[model samples]
Structures are given as C-alpha cells and as structure tokens.
Target: MKHKTPLLDQLESGPWPSFVSDIKREAEARAKNEKGVDFQIPVEVCEDILGVMELTYEQKRTHWKHGGIVGVFGYGGGVIGRYCDQPDLFPGVAHFHTMRVNQPGGKYYNTDFLRKLCDLWDKRGSGLTNMHGSTGDIILLGTYTHQLEEVFYELTHDFNQDLGGSGSNLRTPADCLGMSRCEYACFDTMALCYDLTNEYQDFLHRPAFPYKFKFKFDGCPNCCVASIARSDMSFIGTWRDDIKIDQEAVKAYVAGEIPPNAGAFKGRDWGAFDINAEVIDLCPTKCMAWDGKKLSIYTPECVRCMHCINVMPKA
Candidate 1:
C-alpha cells in the first residue's frame, strides 16, 4: 500500500493556476487510483480536504510574519501595517496589514480626506477597513512588507499633522454629536475631543501604560455611543434639577380644562417609586397633598423630581 499524496501537494508544485481546481483533480485521481471511482465520497470530503489543505498552505505562508508602523500624512498620520518577514517564524501575516486613521467627532471626515484615504488603501492596503477599531481609530487592513514604509510615508505625506493610533499612548478619543446637532447637549463634545487629541499626541504614540486606556464623551443622558459599557473613562451629560413649574402656567392649564396629564408633565408615572408620606407629611409647609383629582405641590416644599409638578404642572 502506498501513502496517498495530499491534495495540496500539487499547489506546492511550481506555480499552480488554481488551488481549488488542483485539489479537485487530485481528488479525482485519488478516486481512480483507489479503484473506488464508482463509489461516491461524501461531498464533505472535498470541503474537509480543502479546508485542511488551505490551513496547511496558510501555515506555510505564516511561517514568518513581518510588521512595522506606517502613518498617513497630516492631521496625524494613521498607524499602518504589522507585517512579519520570517515565514518560518511569522508566515501569512505578510498578506494582511492594519492601518489606523483618525476619525473626527461624530466620525466625520471631509471629502478630500476620505478620497485620499480610499486611494491609499486601494493602491497599497488589503482594500479592507475596520472603520473604527477598539480605540475609535479607523482601521485599515492588509499590506506587504516592502510596501510598509512606502505606504506609511504616502499616507502620512511625510508626517505633517499627526497620526491617530498606535504604541502605548492613548488611542483616539470619541465624542457624541454635540451642541451642533443635539438639543440636549450642554458642552462642545467635538471641540473637546479634538483638543484632547491634539494636546496628547505624544501619549497617543508612545506605549507607557500597564494597559490601554480609552476616553469617550456623550452629549447627554441618552448615551448613544455606549461609552459606559466599554470605556475606561467616560463623560455623560445629565440634568441635575427637576422640571420647573409655573403657577400661571398651571392656572392656564386649569382654565383651558386640559387633562391633568397634558403638556410637559404628560405620560409621567409618579407612583413608580414608593413615596414616603411620612417625609411628605413632615413637610414644613403642608405643601404635599393628594386631592383625588390632582396632587398639590407647595412650591416652598417642592424639592423637584417633578413628582407633583408632573401631576399638576400648573401648581
């Protein structure tokens, strides 16, 4: 009995046109040689054999990996490429590179910048992008060893502005859509994110921590960015006081004969929490009252939370 040649053995032969076709041919030949031509091997045989062959090929390709940093020029060039040269040691990694591009607040990029980035990726990268890695930098993938520095230089245009990601320093800072778009925004999240990035360029490039750190900002309580779940440091805006009630507004509401639940105080469930009447009853001004038709809140004893205010905004 002779040992069967593996399906991939042919791909290792001089330059093969298509590994898949080569495997198919090998499979046919194996069937013929085994006197099992009439017997149908499971379709899964092809899949399993091809998978194993591809894995083997990939293992050979990754035997030596090459890696280095490349940066896009201006506005802080992004970090690109982590390729390895030694196949015996690092292999298939040469086929893939990782590049980081800085994303502005709200992940907005000007048309010129976007075009330049796309052109660069098409010319040199794997033509794939992660569009914001874990650190919030746009991640470009795939490149070769020889193309690393050239791609880096081309992307950075000679290190003019600054790059956004890499090393031990702080990654890109992400911010929510601030005052420009959100009505509840109280601060300029965009300006703050940019300021932090510019002020800490050194920190962004140098690895100087036991672990990586991330900073994120939310314009309001809605927290659209999921900052609280992932960021080490996060800032979210929230109102500290309760809703304000105007007595005149309440009178107008009453005169208008609007439902007690109408207006800014509508659809509120004040009873969601157990109210302590002992605390309300001890009110220095007997301001808390439930009159079946409406709750009365003496402005003097009203500490906010809009409990009574929601029940009777005209209070």
Candidate 2:
C-alpha cells in the first residue's frame, strides 16, 4: 500500500535529511537487532513531524501502554513521564522514559560543548531529542531504564552538566539577554541565574511543593523571554528613578532625524506622534500623553515599569 505521504515525501527531495527516511532507518535497524520482536515505524511520530495524517491505524492495538511514574532520584527537576498504551506491541517506547539536561543560561554554547554533549547522548541514550522542553531543559525524549543512571552519571561527572528540574519543584531558572547583549538591562541576569541555580540545587532535586513552580527573568519590561506569561515567579528589570527627558533627542525623534524602526522598517515613517500614541495607550496609569511633538509623563504616578524608557530609548 502507498504510504500516502505526499508532503512528507517532498521533504526527501530537499538537501536536508528526510525525517521519514531517518525513522525508516530505525525501523530497519530494529528489525535486524531483535530477531522475533515486531516494531513498525510509528505513524504517530511521522504525523507529528509533518503535522499531517495521511494514513490510518494499521494495527488493531498499538504498543503504547501507560506505565508507572518515571523519574530519577535526588532530583525532582529533570525527568518527564511518558507511557505507551501498548508496551507489548511497541517494546522500544514501552517505558515512560525521559532524560532532562539543564540548559546553560541564555543558551550560549560553544560548538565544542554542543558536539561533546551530542556525542555522549548518542552513545549512551536514544538519539531522539526534544532539543528543548517546555521547562527549557535539554530533553532527551527516550532512554532505557537501566541506562538512565549511567547516562546521567557520564553527563554530570564527566561532562560536568546536570539535569534540570521536573515535577512539583523549583525548575531550572531561565534568563533573557541581560547585560550580555541588551543595553536595556538593569541587572546582570546571566550572573544572577547562575547564582540562583547553584544556590537552589537542593530544591531542584527534591519535590517538596504542592505543584510545579518556575522562575524566569527578563532584562527589561519587553520580556523577550515571555517571563510574565509563563513563569510563576517573574523578574523584570525596572528603575524607580524619574525618566530623564532629553528634549533635543525628543525633537530629533519628532523631526525624523532618528530612525524609529530598525532594518527593513528603517524607511517607514514611524512618526513621533504615532509611536507616542502607542506608548500612551499601553500605559496602565493613564500618565502618558503626547501632542504631536511634545511628550508628557505624570512622574508621581509612574509605576516604574520601564516601558516608555525601553520603547523610546532616545527620550
């Protein structure tokens, strides 16, 4: 029967590795290694990759049966539970196995570190990876139960990397580009992230909470890391001091001497009046107003959100 994967098949025509072909390789390898074990390329995995379901269930029963709770000891932070409904049918993914590696602050990595990490995981665990999980950990999606400890040991003791948090614990803290690359930062988010993670190692490894909690930091109110929406504890840089007004700079901005937008938007006439209107509308306290060329802020009522300061860096 035809695979009915037109769009999926098209991916093979490109120079990039075909996702289907790769899984097919795994299927072939499984057939060779286990003489009597029956394993078929998972149609669900394929569907997820392409986001298209062209085929129906080939088996009356799939091998994905839910298993018992899955995790490693001493660390509540680094394991995710998964179960196959029909384990007898799918022996490979039978266990609710997950491996979580703590990510470095801000995702800054040298190619050497990446290469070494990949090599270790490939050697000891399943090659499949989520790359990054929702909790911002390096998610090794599958691994054998017997091999989890050894893999983690090698990763930690040898590579000096550690597992992230999971299940009702203080998860690995996350950070946005703070003093590193962004001028808007009021603090060194990277340094603080490292400090917090190291200090809270005990908390990360122990599940002592009523529910999972997360801490995330943003350099400024822009919150490029989605800290406010996603985290239970959100820290954003702000200033309590009054916003300094540079009338000359403001006039220059109004006169179009300064480029309002960067890159392709450079030429667009994002006049001062329009930008000011946008800023004023977003201010919750109704403390902002603009009259074509002049900008006014009710300093006393200002909440020190750093919103206007970030939006218009010149004024």
Candidate 3:
C-alpha cells in the first residue's frame, strides 16, 4: 500500500523534475517485491526516508540531529554523523550517517570499478550516492553507525580507496580535467591534484586547521572548476608567452570568409563576423590593431584575456 505523502507528491506536479518521485517509484517497486537492476535497498528504508522528509516539511524544521565524534579508528574526519530525532516513527533513518570517499583526480572511472564500488555501498549503505559533494568528495549518503568501520575497512583493504576530509581537516582537493582533454590547459592538473592529495594525507585525515581549507586547481584561465570562488587556495595555469598569430587566418576572418570561433556558431545565424568590433575592440588592454590587410598585436601590453583568440580561433 502507498503511504500518504501529500507534501512530497506536491513536489512532482511542477515542471521541474523531482527526486521525491524517483524515491517513491523505487519504494513502490520494492513494496511489490520487484527486483531492481542493481541490488535492492530495503523498502522500509526508502519509506522511512520519505516519511522523515514529509515530517520535515510539515514541521518547518529538520527531524535530524548531529554531534559528537563518529569515525573509524585512527582517522579523525571524513564520516559525518547523522541521526533522526523521531526514531520511533522513522527507525530506518535513525543512524543514517554520511561518508565521504576521496575521488580519483579528474574523476576518471571505468564501468567495472564503478560497479564494484556501488555493490559495496549497496551492501553497507543506503544505496544513494552523490557523484561529488560541494567540496568534490564522492558522497556516500546514509549508513548505520555499526557498519561504518566495516565499510571503511573494505573500502581501504579491498578497493585501495580512502576517505576524504571533514570537520576542521584540510578538505579534499579538486582539479579540472586540464590537459587530459582541453587544448588550452598549460599544466598537468590531475598529476598535481594526485600529488597534493597523497602528500598531505595527515592533514586530510586529522583536524589540524582552524577551519576547513580547500585546494582547487584549474588547467587554464578558463577556471572550469570554479576554484577562485570556492577554495581557500586556488591554482590557475597561465603562461608568460604571447599568443601566436596567423596572418593569413586573420585576413580570412577579417574578410568574413571564415566563421568566428571556428564555425562554432555556424548552426545559428548570428550575423557576419567583425574582427575589429569583436576582437580588437573587446581586448581588455586594447593591445590589438587591424589594418584591413594585416592584424597587429602589442604583445608587450597583451593581457592574455583570450578575447582575440576566442573570436578568431584559427588566428
């Protein structure tokens, strides 16, 4: 039988997709003794999770509480303790602690690795996973307090994986794909991230900081990882060298024979390309000049704003 969840059902009515709907679908499927493509989490766990969510909405406050040290032996961080206040009403979530697994640099993963990791969590956790948390750790959401040690031991011994940082410890370091895929990347971001993570294992596992500290590395000025805005320490790759200019390609762009951004906007009719208006005029330092037949760049004053390169990619 489907339990009453009027508040949660209301979330499914809007245009935006809702997680409540997905959880309810899983709960209903489990209630009917339906087998799941992956290992099935107990139906009661899902229902209780929904029940607590409904109660939270009804009460206008959380039904959860947390405090005190809760982690595996020798490690002082990584596991977050969570408990339900209404244990009698929602027993399944009474000890739904969260664990953070340190993700591989650049988040590279194969199907076989993921399948095995998921199988481990399904057996010991609530079967929900967030690819990355706010700090870029793989979030293993919900597990019993008693199973924490077992999960950690298996995660380390079998998978050769470790937990990320939490509390006042140095939070997990994150990095963009960089040279792995992007042409603009100036350095090996993944390698640096891997080195730093391993080198500072003690700081990552122990609460030595006054507050949480984070490190984020971006391959180039693009800063795809949003390091500047989020992390305490940010590394953005840059070069002192000037950008190369192709005179013939410049003329092609100027004459409207070649598309801007290398025909990236070809699918849409965004009007003719104007190098003077788009590239020269938009330069932050105004270090570019076009004289109909040739293009000139004042490399000494160039800021590497990438405006010229962005508009005339080939040039």
Candidate 4:
C-alpha cells in the first residue's frame, strides 16, 4: 500500500530526522506487526495524527466539538468530560477520556514501578501515555465510559496507586527534589508533597472553588520549579533562624578556594576578596555586614530574600 502523505514522505527524503518521518515509521511498524495496529482508532486516525504532526494555519481552526459532559463514579478527579461533535463518526471515543494515577512525590519513580504502570495501561486503556501532563498526572490518554470503574479499581486496589485530581479541584501537589539532591534546601520538599497529597484527598476529588487551584512547593527560595508564578497556592521553604555561617569557609571563599554551598567570592582580588564594599553593597534590606575576619547578621531585619546567602553560601 502507498503512504497517504507523499509530502510528509518527501520531508524524510533529506538528511535531517523529521518528526513526521518518526511518526511514519511507528505507524508502519504498527500496521505490520504491533499490539496497537488498528485498535479502535478512527478510519482517519492516521491522517489525524499526521495533521497534528504537520500543522498548518488551517489545522489550527478545529471545530468546537467537545460539548458533552461525563463523569465516573467515586471520583470527581480523574474523569475528563468531553464528547465528539459527530459521535456517530467517532463512536469509540465519543464518551470521554479518563485520567487516574497517583503521582510519585518528588517525581521519583523506580524502573519496576514504571514497567508495571505501562503494562497495566497497555492491558486496560490505550497504550498511549504522557510521562506527566501539565497537571502532573501520569496521563492515561484514552478510555471509554464502560471501563472507568475497572480501571480505577485496578489502579487503586491492585497496584495501590491513587488517582490524581482534575477539574476545579486541588491538583496533585508537586515540588522540586529538595533535601534529596540539593544542598540549598531548607526543608524536605518531597515529604511535604506526599503529605499534602494524602491529607487533601477529599479536596483533590471535590471541586469547591470558583476556578481550579494548583499547589506547588519549592524547597528553597531559589524556586527551581517557578512555583511562585504558576501555582495558585505556592509554598517555598525559608529560614527564620539566623543563617549558619562558617568562618573558616568564609576564609576559604576570601582566599578564593570557593567551597561549594558555603560561598563563592570574586576571583579578581587574588587572596583578599573585597567583602563589604562591592559584594554586599546592594542588599535591599542591607542586613548583612562582613568585618575583615568575620561576618555578622542583623537577623531581625533580614527579610529572608536569599540575595546575600546565594552569593556567599559557605559564609
């Protein structure tokens, strides 16, 4: 049989590895001898996949088709309510797709955990998955109305995996890997993520607010996850106690040894780094002062903004 997309085939004629080429390879392999070869996909499914792959301005103008509402029992979290405009055309996918999976705290997953998850999805739903979608669930991309309960049961009872939130609920809380891998962390971000998720299961499954609320936690003021800007509810770990300063490490920084996390000094001045005049000059609160041999903190007025500590990690 000839490929329907001759233009997309032409794109593969060049040296560069086109994504369309990759999609074509997968489609070809599946059509020949693969598990997901023609499993309930639309007649135009290949064209639909290619349409998304090679998008045009006209492709962006898709019809507003999803007007139907659907939900599964015992959960308000996982069901993604939708309907195809022409249900008769897409009978296999007309009801809605469901998403239900427990997110690993700190985004940690063992190989066995991942393997089992994939095996289950291959058995129950479409083999397609998103490692994690924007909402931070292990997205099970396709399923029908009849199988939602069985899917939820197998996930919850057999695998011990809980469902993640959707709709106008508290979505699964996520965070940067805190005390596990980072030295700058003020708290155990992973543990907090787990704690919040478990404690707020009801809230996650129930929509109580006017709009969706998201929770993102960061271990330090560095905010590697950008939680502050994106999440509706953001929490970053901080120090209320005076920052621990190591005088010897300060000496090392001054001598330009620049030990990790203790601090880094301007390497310009060979052995005598200028501490006060240039380094701490522009602190918004002006709460830190470095004497010739020692650093002192006016702890009360320190706003915990992380400006000075970021520069001088050791000291």
**Model 2: how far is 178 from its true place, Å?**
0.9
For each candidate, the alpha-carbon lDDT, in order, equals 0.55, 0.67, 0.83, 0.67
TM-score per candidate: 0.53, 0.75, 0.89, 0.74
RMSD of each: 14.1, 6.1, 2.6, 5.1
1-315 per-residue lDDT for model 4 (tens digits): 132555566777888877566555544553553554334333233334554333333355543256344555766766775544444544434544757576777678889888877666555555557777776678875556666677788778877888787778888787888999988788988988888888888988887767788899889888887789878988899976777778887777666677433434434443445566535675778887777788777878777777666766766
What's model 1's overall lDDT? Answer: 0.55
Top TM-score model: 3
Q: Which residue runs does candidate 4 get wrong by more than 4 Å?
A: 1-29, 32-47, 52-56, 86-100, 123-126, 259-286
lDDT by residue for model 3 (176-241), tens: 988898887889999999999999999999999899999999987778889999899999988867
- How many angstroms is residue 226 displaced in model 4 relative to the true structure, after the best TM-score fit? 2.9
Number of the candidate with higher lDDT, 2 or 3: 3
Clashes of 4: 5
- TM-score of structure candidate 4: 0.74
Candidate 2 wrongly placed segments (more than 4 Å): 1-64, 262-264, 267-284, 291-293, 303-307
Clash totals for all models, in order? 41, 12, 0, 5
